[model samples]
Target: MNGPSLAIRQRSLGDLTAEFPLFPPLTRGCPKSSTDEIAYPLEVGYDYARVDPGLFDQTPGTDIARWSPLLPPLAAPTLGEGGTPLVEFEGIHFKDESRNPTWSHKDRLNRVTVSAALAAGAPGVVVASSGNHGASAAAYAARAGLRAIVLTSADSPPAVQAFARAYGARVVSVPAEARWPLLREVVDRLGYHPVSNQTVTHTGHPFGPEGYKTIAYELFLQLGQAPAAVFTPTGYAELLYGVWKGFVELKLLGLTGTTPRMFACEPAADGPHARALATGAPAAIVETFPSAAYGIAGPVGGHRGVLAVRDSGGEAVLVTDEEMRLAQRDLAGQGLWQELSGAAGVAGYRKLRREFGGPVVCVGTSSGFKDLGVGAQTYPVLEHPTLDDLRA
Candidate 1:
């Protein structure tokens, strides 16, 4: 099935002003209008006049690109990225995104961003990620027959590094602070389409988050109504913003009555979004400490996250490493093993004691195998096993 021919426009999040013809992914660090003071992630909006509501009624199946009227116009390469199972356990529904092709929610983002790279005629793609994002981007780029360069910190998980390399992507390890600068240099010199952020405030790829909207769409379709709240593990807040935007679009189309409250879950060691919200700033930077959930440990918070939380009447919640560990164990007991960072949503949900009174979804972003510490366990070795030892 082909998507409807729709014209794309770039709208500034700082102001309501929009510009036609989406060119140059990030204009001067972020999508901006002439009069905007704060630079924010440019929203990819469509001319709704050309859209037919009936088009959305078509079964999207596993490929999210099927909802093309609400997405950028491009032929995306899909590896069964979407249509993950929404499982219910202990009064909370879990959007198990670990079932994706790359075992992470990032496959949704990479599917669209890699297509953007192909549409723009870029040589390849470049991304900076410690784990899931890099692996997913490499997989998509490989599917599209394009070169992929993955930049990650030197201390990134070896399993994740191997996953990227297994997809035939060039993996480079650099200092945590040098990844972004090197990404920009590659984009400028090699003309590689950057699938990650290059700006100081972390305005991610324009087309990337649009893919995440499918999660919200799926939730509405499955439940036939909006949930009370959506808890998501946040780094740059791309998924949080994208999911909120999806709910807003549904309300705008009159398909849904209202949007759900969004919760941004971050590690307590580095809760830049929380800090930004407390300070009432568009963005904020903080010194990050080590945590078991390194995949979502971002030192800088972006304006996109703040907007999603504030607009949805939601708040940011910080979870400690211990809290996340407990949540991970809880998910495991429910037959869902998630990475420490992937369990942040559950941790946040537990931290917030308010009664939601309705269905609540916590996004499980990745599988437990992505964590570097997952492979360190060893079984006891015995020359002879006795009945007592077996019982013990």
Candidate 2:
């Protein structure tokens, strides 16, 4: 993974201040400006001037760790998380992230964050997630020979719980509000790495989203140019910001003519990003309603997502549960079965049918198997019947 010499720094998303080192994995919300009302997330900043765009010209391999120059340096093990297929169906390009090792886009995030844990010499990794994040973190921790502890909601899907336990992670079912506070205690007492958000506002691990930048890099190489738009399912908007940052870097390196419009797709039941954008606020806390797309039902919005949407001339789009269900079925009809949240990008595209033209990319972020009620539907079966009986 050797490349040009690299130095990593932490920058505040609020004022673009480079005040912190990249190590120790900072996740605290950035300091707020006197004039501003809220603090922003800190981001992992690289010396992009030293990066060679030619390094990205090569077709991406199965290992995302190969993009080490753009990411924080760590000796993390790999499970072939990146290089997912970019398939076209119904006039849209789909980045099939569900094909990743852990069957979700969270695999990319955990790949780097777990590396941060190992680099910091932490005893283990801890995460609070209802589904994908916990499962992915647990698997990566196992790969790196570190203990894993996951705090999930008591009502988390059986499959997600099983997946984490299968990887030898200690899965604790706790109240929703208690997860973050408990994670903080674990980090303080046991010296474990906290991979998810612990702040009141969601400033996730600084190095985690760097793993998702590979999606934009892959899209460019696969299409030979940047698409007109990219729609991603948004929870904390980590993937949304990561993909947007990737394209921004390409333009900075004289590789792409223009960046795509980044769309942060969220469940309408709880669209904190959309609410923040609509209200002209740095962040928003929205009252949430139940939705089958539980994976993306984040109650709070973050500053990173707002920056991504505003900078890229993108907008936050909300899709209803029914819209997501229809989109999921449509993908299944085309032989791509995604979880309801994974289909939010497509649902958003449908909602904005008249807005954009030209090539568009929508990321299918996870597999259908991650959905809690995915297998509840069944069809009647008849035995000992002939073709006539079947027709009747």
For candidate 1, write residues 315-344 as lDDT tens digits: 999999999999999999999999999999
Task: Please provide TM-scores, in order, for all candidate models, with all chains considered together.
Answer: 0.95, 0.95
Q: Per-residue alpha-carbon lDDT of model 2 for 338-362, expressed as tens digits?
A: 9989999999999998546668999
How many residue-pair clashes does candidate 1 contain? 0
lDDT of each: 0.86, 0.87
State each model's C-alpha RMSD to the native.
Answer: 2.0, 2.0
